[model samples]
Target: MNDDSRKAGGADQDPFFMRDPEKLAANLARTIEEAGKAAGFWSRARESGMVSDSSFDPFADMLRVFSALGQYWFSEPSRSFEAQTRLFTAYMGVWMRSMQELTGQAEPDKPEAKRPDKRFHDPEWVQNPFFSSLRQIYEVTARWAEELVERADTLDDLTRLKARFYVRQIIDAMAPTNFVVTNPAVLRETLKSNGDNLVRGMQMFAEDLREGGGIPRLRQSDLGAFEVGENLATTPGKVVARNDLAEIIQYAPSTGKVLKRPLLIVPPWINKFYILDLNEKRSFIRWAVSQGHTVFVISWANPDERHRDKDWDAYIGEGIEFALDTIKARTGEDEVNAIGYCVGGTLLSAALALMAETGDQRIASATLLTTQVDFADAGDLKVFIDEEQLQALEEAMERKGYLEGGRIAMAFNMLRARDLIWPYVVNNYMRGEPPLPFDMLYWNSDSTNLAAANHSYYLRNCYLENNLARGRAELRGRKLRLSSVKIPIFNLATADDHIAPALSVYNGSRLFGGPVEFVLSGSGHIAGVVNPPAQRKYRYWIGEVHEEGFERWLETAEETEGSWWPHWQQWIEAQGNETVAARSFGPDEEALDDAPGKYVRKRV
Candidate 1:
């Protein structure tokens, strides 16, 4: 290669740049052999009845979408003609633009009028005629496909929602940026490295497939850089209690005077509890401790097949209730304030109902962060929940005795594939580059398997049936009603949350038979909730719950600058600001482990 080629292929331009044609060919051959081996392994597993045929098929919802589209198109010839004409018209515009550009007669495209897309941000995507046309073609086709689903009036609301979601996934997967030939960046890297990038990418692909046990598990972060207690979950605390379902960590006080009423945090079992204790800078646990409150976080056990029968009853009884009992024992306080995030918040809400029924009043006030008791409008996550899909999921979970953690991770990733999946694919596989070490991404990648009974109940009652909202949800042979739980409740919802919509959370706030304070935070699920006052990023809104709707309430709500952490602190303090000398795990108390306990360290 000449000096110009070397300059183009420099390490500064492409991190994975290397000049070794022999090694590239060898790596390519090995990758091909690995692919063949993986195919054979899957084929043999299927033949042996270890894997079902349906497992090999694409998502059934995708097929249902095509079926619906086919019915719509075949119902009338002009319907199909109209769709084709629309697509062709879009193509004609692209072709004319390309020709105009080629002849130096084209006017600049209206960038502001176009949809904001990160994938097409590369200058070559617009400057190069070939790539510009390809980008236009993909965008046009994607829009057309979505329009067909929207126009299919015969399909029901749920089916149409699923169709639109699946259609987006399909279109996203087919984006020009995902392919080597069409992506200028990847193509440039390929040329610069003399196919070395592809060779390394293939190797990485094979490794991921191997690690995932035949499934491609793309690395979201540099896993080697972060560990649970060492760097990520480095909060100072002690495991004061351990049960089959969880370990209760009582965080060491950062202040001399702590709140008399200790605070217990219930985190989602789907992922590690350390999300709240990621690092010193971002650790909510540490921050809460510093805010003159005794913090106790539930570190849920990463369950396996042995925990298959552990249901919501077990989680509540052996998890939340157990923590309450422990807090009372250690602190000599019965009235403890509590906060729950995501599914943990949902589980806590149910437990509160159960507790109300039994006349157990250990909890004085409740704070639910981005929780949805009513799943009617549970955002895009609902697309994966239907009768057929639920049954399939149940059967699969039954076989393994637990649902694979990666399944949940992949579902969330798909909801934003353009950001999560494809970007990682292009970066890690296409470019043969390692993902940057990020604490949040590290926590996201660290998934936890869900016990069969617990997971099944959550899906059916919460997602599919929307039982909790309707007062039909049951726990421990008793029907639990949200209205029965009359306690001071703080309900928080993120404006841009995808898993739990802000409007759904707003509606849920009305379900609780209590004085509810609904707060709207500025970002999505994790960032919005974990936001610290120190960061001074993102705004929050507080307002009276409007009978009209969330949007109406937003119009009249009081907007406050910076993180919601300080506001929440003030609210909790309002509950009861009386403080006492800080408490710690006594020498006599049995300590199972340090903070960021063993349960979180258990890999799925």
Candidate 2:
């Protein structure tokens, strides 16, 4: 495994490597050797309050404990734990009651039993109380262990962080679903496939060890089916303009006549821009085009070591400004409605603020989606954003020039261990089943790097300092206030976004200095925003952004069924004025390649 991958928690070693008898024997020997060293370290640390020999200090010990507690609580490890705990606790109680019923020793009448977590609501899990009780007992024990770790007063933050991650991983791996001995599905599949699943899984493990630094996220079959322009970002368009930082994609008009003010989408450069143009049905770019709006999506260059020196200001000048210039020149429209997602919105907002200060009026209106301008409560992601972590990250970035996209993916997967981590562990490594070829997952697995300077400046200024919200941020040699962005703005926040919580997004809306329409949509970060009107799956709510709190707004607001895309389009239509002559991406403004462009294809 590469040194970089080892630094990323060493998933390449395969947390479940012991499943093979030979590997288990080898691991057992290694564990014995490592355990002795660990015991020595623990004994030294416990007695002396230092890993190296030193006199122990009670005050120092207390401080270490406090720091650890801060890291644990801040990381939001229990965000989903509570739900799982409740489900298991409830399931155990239900089984107890059901047993009493079966014995004809039941008490008064009550409702039927149900699993706490819907994913584990396997009918078979409930049909047999013995198995159900087993799971519940394991879950209860795991929760107790988590509580014990959280309450530990001796461990430092780094120690606790490692402990918590390992504990959760150990517990998650021990779950019945992970092994044929415990899991019915695995047992059945094993009998049917004659242990061939294990063979494939081992092969996958070997291949992942060979390629992606030992961590295999999805089955190769899942990846084999999709490509960038052919599958995702498939919407027909031309790379009308190209520069060092970004490629401007002016999509083909899906309407007879398009709106006068074209829309230029500024997506987070930390990722490829095609997230807006994922596919035909879900692609926001195609949707905008069909809405009779001239859509232009910026495809950011996938940065390498070459882009290590490219800072945040470079993105503003070359990324946003460069695209803005192209949109104006092509459409002959002086002002264009701009939409920014994630960090892109943060930059666009800064740009608008700078422009407002400098008397530049290139933007007609603005829409910020699932993005944050305020860093105070940037959600569980903040757990890894504190001073020590940032400094360590900076050191790593300095060595690499840019932070690998895989590293970022690991952090996010950690945030939602159950949803993002363990299921894939089972599917790709245990069951040997290929993951579904979902479009969003494809985009998710396909990640892009953050340049060292770009990321460090952002981490220090925006996340660490919280300077942007304080109006202390400087851009293009000018001090700027974010609130100076007085353009009419529409903001969308997904209810379950872990990266940028709905409330955080709401707080950013308060920073805007114009008419604000804040809509709270259902689902999570990416899925919530990508929702098309056709899904008709999740609901959204829009209440007046009053002095009332976000919780108060939720309590009082009425939810409207279906996607917020229509509502957003309505707002844009009103702000963009009337429709004009249709214009397909005029022949590539200095064409480099096609719509998906060279930048989208660049991978680490």
Candidate 3:
């Protein structure tokens, strides 16, 4: 037949009989028929004792199919009701088998067997017929809905549809699945291993529910906790520290004499400064105190909205300047050794640079821990600091008068979304398991807000413009230049840090025009800095040439493992004045009272 005649005949044929239409209608009809058949089969199976009354309910299965179809239809432009219905049925079938196993029901094909391990016992909630049925129904319905959504061809449309939900699914799917097991037959073996894990997870959830807890509280494992030096708490040394917002805690050493040079610790306002004085065994502060160093940490005041107006200049003026002056006044010394951590480190660098520009030399030595003076290569976080994102974030902060800590945490988490966010999704939702409490997670959750002005300025200038590395950064109208501050510098960075990559930290040595000792610690950002010697999980690489780049120095430097704190101690001791004398910054200012300063205490 001619093409035109064939086309006319095709158009004239029954609409339902057309190729595409027929296929689609057939698929839909088949889905509805199968769904009805499934309902009947389940009902018969229940009556035939193939599935226990407690494990299977025909009504619940119907609800799941209805819910899945409803969701699928509601998704307008992208519809897959039949496909989703099939997925729903498949998921329900699997869940029914699982429920049967938990409810002491024996399948005709395979007999039920009891697990010998108490840890593998099914939870009471899982055994409860009502809860189990409801859970399976909901899970199957949700999974099917997700399957429908995931079938979309375009990410752009998916992003606009349910952006966060789709992002989470994408992240979960992409998360690391590889393990170090070498056996070729490990897949089947691992399934057996997973059976026990599933049971254990179920039991864990039941216990938590029984106790009215969502997650188990985590404790410092035996291997995680270590003691600090004995001298950490020996005496109420010349330095008396107080947290006005919290309580006053006195730290004294047994030394007959304090160091002639006073020490001032500048910790990032983001975290508590106790990391330096973590415990008796791993405490760097304790070790320094034993070595007769007159040390004092600037416990930042956790600020609230009341202190929203406080800018970077104010932090330098009232915070570091105040601490430095106080130390100078107390010790009767003109200069003090300053140590800064992370943001605190950057602030110290700025302060020193500003001081040097004005020819003020109160800072004798600057030791920066996991600190970044140049933000040119600031790692993964750079992605979120792009112009568009920064503008949106700035607008957000302007409305709130501060950058919310939760927002900042979210940004950080995005750098490793699969690791940080998706695992929780799989455990909490997919597996019906509760989250496990972790101290690090607790600390991470306890976040602090950043002042609106400071955050906005920091992003626009340092991260976006690369001002710090370019030497165009300014503090209070004064151009801040690291090279101008020719002071002895000690810069330390961790190898696996995501926030401040080692390469970025290493670039600091080149930025400074003075003698720089670049040390590479073995750990992530926080862990590396909080590392105490007792853990024995740290290593460091140090290079002698202060002017050379990190890569060049790495080629010549020796690699060594263990805490680098002792090495830092030796470096400080070598540069610090040997004489022991009480040097006070000023008369004990009763302005604030101890560990967590007021600024840190302010809620995000």
Best by lDDT: 1
Clashes of each: 0, 2, 34
Model 3, 222-305: lDDT tens per residue?
Answer: 212322122222223332434332222324544777767777888776665656664556566777777777777776655556
The candidate 3 region of ten consecutive residues with least summed lDDT is 178-187
TM-score, prediction 1: 0.94
Flag the better candidate by lDDT, 2 or 3.
2
Candidates in order have lDDT scores of 0.85, 0.73, 0.59
Q: How accurate is candidate 1 locally (lDDT)?
A: 0.85
Where is the poorest 10-residue window by lDDT in model 1? 49-58
lDDT of 2 by residue, 253-293 (tens): 87898888888899987677877788887887888889888
In Å, residue 167's CA in model 3 sits off its true spot by 9.6
lDDT of 1 at 521: 96
- Please rank every candidate by TM-score, starting with the best: 1, 2, 3
RMSD (CA, Å), each prediction: 3.4, 10.5, 18.4
Q: Residue-wise lDDT of candidate 1 within 495-553, one digit each (tens)?
A: 88988899999999999998899999999989998898889899999999868987799
Q: Which residues of candidate 1, in runs, are more than 4 Å off?
A: 1-31, 37-58, 108-114, 587-590
Please report the candidate that would top TM-score against the real structure.
Answer: 1
lDDT of 1 at 430: 85
